[model samples]
Target chain A: ELKVEQNPLFLSMQEGKNYTIYCNYSTTSDRLYWYRQDPGKSLESLFVLLSNGAVKQEGRLMASLDTKARLSTLHITAAVHDLSATYFCAVDPYNAGNMLTFGGGTRLMVKP
Target chain B: SAVISQKPSRDICQRGTSLTIQCQVDSQVTMMFWYRQQPGQSLTLIATANQGSEATYESGFVIDKFPISRPNLTFSTLTVSNMSPEDSSIYLCSVGRTDTQYFGPGTRLTVL
Candidate 1:
């Protein structure tokens, strides 16, 4: 079974705090994606890391992929209440066609 | 990124009944997918809907429980049969074109 595991399933932070969510996969994959979903809402694309050392950043959110380590990270800087949501990391195994296998997700709660 | 939309943002249904959720994309896409997100859980791929062809379901999902239809390149429907409270979740539609996937707003289903 191909499994994607994420650390810190739940996190609470104060404004201006920083944290990093880690995603580790059991299989070899070259493409990883980060997504955010609010309560009762659908997913919003965050970042797509396609290769080792691939890093993408938008605003205060940054995502990086280390294929050799079979890991990816989503780093939050200067957290805000608006960033409070569930974050998921999806891994696409090199041979899994275009389907995505998602992790259990990390729930983030940013407080002022 | 394609704009995807799902009908019936939220609904309350009784058990033993069925509900059909519609997904529409702003532009024609090569592939459409359906996913389910249980409470506080990550998104799980239900199946991949291909235009003019039968859907390919995941390992745990079956066509009888979740029937999918893709009439064209930009529209699809997923029907949940004999609903139960265990089937309560948010159903999302995603569009895949040019190697990227974008999600719809989702349909929240509450089976009682």
Candidate 2:
């Protein structure tokens, strides 16, 4: 079974601070996805990392993948109040087809 | 990215009743997926919906309990049968094209 783990499940950070959320998978995966969900809302696609060194950034967030280590990272640069949301990482194993195994998620509270 | 929408954005249901959530995509997709998210948790893929075929469910989920219908390329539905308090959750559907995936807004089900 493929397992995805994310640390610092609950994060309380102030605006202007930076932090990195880690996503580590137990098995090799073909692709990784990052999503953000606001309270009582649905998930919004953040980034897609497909290659060993794939890195994607949007606004104030950046995500990178290291396939050899079976790890991925989502870094928040100078977070803002609007960045307060729960972040999740999902992985598709080699033969998973269209199925996704999601991480535990990191809930971020960006305070002013 | 595809524009996906889900019906009944939210509902409060009585236990034992069945609720069918609808998912519609703006464009045709080969595979659509159903996912469940408990309060304050990450997503767990429930099944894979494919047009003109039986939906493939994940372990710990059964076809009878969570029946899925994929009658066409741009639409699918997932029915939760005999709901319980434990079944209270947010259900989302997604579609994938090549390597990118898009998600619906989600349906929040509160079973009492």
Candidate 3:
């Protein structure tokens, strides 16, 4: 069975602080995606890490994947209150149909 | 990149009523996925719909309960039949092109 686990399910940090959310998957997969969802809203795509050692950054957020270790990290730099939302990491297991197993999201609240 | 949209951003329905959610993608896609996010929980994929094939439902989902129709390459519909309070959730639709998937805004349902 494939499972994705995320730590620090609820996070509260001050603006300008740096933090990282870790996602660990039980199976090997090359496609890992990160999404952000605000309250009562749908998901917004943030990153799509497709290979080992693949790192992508956009503005204040950066995401990296390590296929060998079956882990991914989402790093937030200079966190702002506007960045407060739930972050979810999903891995598409190398199944024949390519189904995704999602991690329990990490809800971050950035303080002013 | 694919731009996805869902109809009836939100609805409040009574128990035993059924609701249909429509998903539209800006471009043709090979596979469309439907997911449900319950309150305070992660997402669970309901099914995968292909243009000319019967939808493949996940473990806990069935065709009779959540019937899906893929009329074309860029459009699909998911109906929550005989809904109860437990069916109240955010229903999201995604289109997979290549390896990455793009999600629609989602339909928020409130079953009373």
Model 1, span B1-112: residue lDDT tens: 7888889888999999999999999988767889998877888999999998899999999999999999988899999999999999999988755545678999999999
Error of 1 at A69 (Å): 0.5
Which portions of model 2 show Cα errors greater than 4 Å?
A95-97
lDDT of 2 by residue, B22-65 (tens): 99999998899999999877899999999999999999999999
- Can you write out model 2's per-residue Cα lDDT over A1-112, one digit (the tens) per residue? 8899998799999999999999999998759999898898888888889889999988999999999999999999999999998999999885343688999999999999
After TM-score superposition, the amount by which residue B9's alpha carbon in candidate 2 deviates from its true location, in angstroms, is 1.0
TM-score of chain A of each: 0.96, 0.95, 0.95
**Candidate 3 structure quality by residue, lDDT tens digits, A1-112:** 8899998799999999999999999988888999899988888889988889999999999999999999999999999999999999999897333467899999999999
- Specify the highest-DockQ model's number: 2
Cα lDDT of model 3 by residue, B1-112, tens digit: 7789999899999999899999999988888999999998999999999999999999999999999999999999999999999999999998876667778899999999
Off by over 4 Å in 3: A95-98
lDDT of model number 2: 0.92
> How far in Å is the alpha carbon of B1 misplaced in model 1?
1.1
lDDT (tens digit, per residue) of candidate 1 on A1-112: 8999998899999999999999999988888989898877778888887778999999999999999999999999999999999999998775333578899999999999
Whole-model lDDT per candidate: 0.89, 0.92, 0.91
